[model samples]
Target: MYELKTKENDRSVVEFIENVESPTKREDAYKLLDIFTETTGYQAKMWGPSIIGFGSYHYKYPTGHEGDAPLVGFSPRKAKISLYFATGDTKREELLENFGKHTTGKACVYINKLADVDVAVLKRLIEQSVRFLQDTYPNNNTN
Candidate 1:
């Protein structure tokens, strides 16, 4: 089980964004971080080394393998941005259609830039993903 940290050092996350070499990327990351914070209403957090996470949730499956995972999060990678959608693959195709040009793994959505996507749709997707995860697992760990 992944131990969930109640508090995070927001400064570290901001510092990581500030240190990005590309000026444009850095500025845009800050802007999106603002949007993410406003949209999710969950304080931003640094998950692991790079992922800037929003709220968090706890999961336990039939096998008893469970852990604390962020409700929604994203990372500004060198090649592209990665959004974590902790939900199923049922609505994956539908969301991709309107989410603009992007790629997807089992649960991660990749976008080259914010300019290529709709902020509203992205926010909705994150909101939906968080809700789904919350509903799927009654024992949510947001503290």
Candidate 2:
């Protein structure tokens, strides 16, 4: 069985933000905390050691691999803030087209700062990701 490293934990979200090496990143983390909280209507929880996550859902693949993951989350990393979102949603790509300056990986969106992105679009992305996951894995949520 494969283990997921980024499981949710009882660590302090505030303490994690406070320890961010860059003051600017720390401030942005707080701002992101507020935005994500208000948008998701869920209190932030620490995922692993770094990610500030909101809601969670359990997923099982066709191969029988399964795990729980946050609906949406972000980490104020050394180089850029990584935003987590659902991977297979076409709407996610459409929204990212107007999401201001950001880079996307398989499931992570990277941005230099909050100013570089539209907060409204960010909220939509959060909502869409949560909705998609909840629909995909109905009744399996830890929200």
Candidate 3:
């Protein structure tokens, strides 16, 4: 069986944010916290050591691998802030087209700062991710 490293934990979200080394990144973390919370209507939780996550869902792969993951989350990393969103959603790419300056990987979008991107588009991405995961894993309780 494979283990997921990014499981949710009881760590304090505020404490994690406060410990962020960069003052700018720390400020951005708080801003993102507010955005994800208001948009998803779910309280933030600490995922792993670094990520601030909102709602969650359980997923099982065809290979019988399964795990719980956050519907949306972000980490203020050393280089850039990584935004976790749903993969395989065509609308995600469509929204990214108008999402201001950002880069995308298989599962995350990277931005230098919140000021570099449109907050409205970020909210849409968060909402779409939550909706996609909810629809894909309907039985998984969120929040």
Candidate 4:
């Protein structure tokens, strides 16, 4: 279950990313957090234990079940960094093509090392993805 933190245990996303042991990964996470939030104009919030998410959107299924979820986010994983730009196949390969070097698993883009990817291109991808999400879900962009 997602543990929603209150003012008592409030933690900033920057602090959470910095807590990671890896210097390179931590820096990358921090930089990406700034870049994503700035470009996407979305607020950053530390979700659950490790995810630093931006924006919020609700999904409605055919079965009438609906739920709210972060529109975009990333996590500093132990093995690699995971970038989240919503879910499913959003035909983001074009952006990925220009996203320098990285591996992907479904909706999450994984980078084994920060040196393997181009940071500028990654920023573009984030901006584009967030814009696309906001366009698709008019109510999600809270910037």
How many clashes does the backbone of model 3 have?
0
Residue 63 miss distance in model 1 (angstroms): 2.0
Task: Judge candidate 3 at residue 86 and give its lDDT.
Answer: 94
Error of 2 at 27 (Å): 0.7
Residue range 49-85, candidate 1, lDDT tens digits: 7788888877777997667778888888888888888
Model 2 C-alpha lDDT per residue in residues 1-143, reported as the tens digit of each score: 67799999999999999999999999999999999999999989999999999999999999999989899999999999999999889999999999999998877999999999999999999999999999999999886
Q: Which candidate achieves the best lDDT against the true structure?
A: 2
What shift in Å separates residue 135 of candidate 4 from its native position after superposition? 2.2
After superposition, the stretches of candidate 2 with alpha carbons farther than 4 Å from their true spots are: none
Clashing pairs in 3: none
Model 1: how far residue 114 lies from native, Å: 0.3
Write one digit per residue (lDDT tens) for candidate 3, span 3-87. Answer: 7899999999999999988999999999999999999999999999988899899998898889999999999998999999999
Winner on lDDT between 1 and 3 is 3
Please give the lDDT score for candidate 2. 0.94
Cα-based RMSD of candidate 3: 0.8
Arrange candidates, best TM-score first. 2, 3, 1, 4
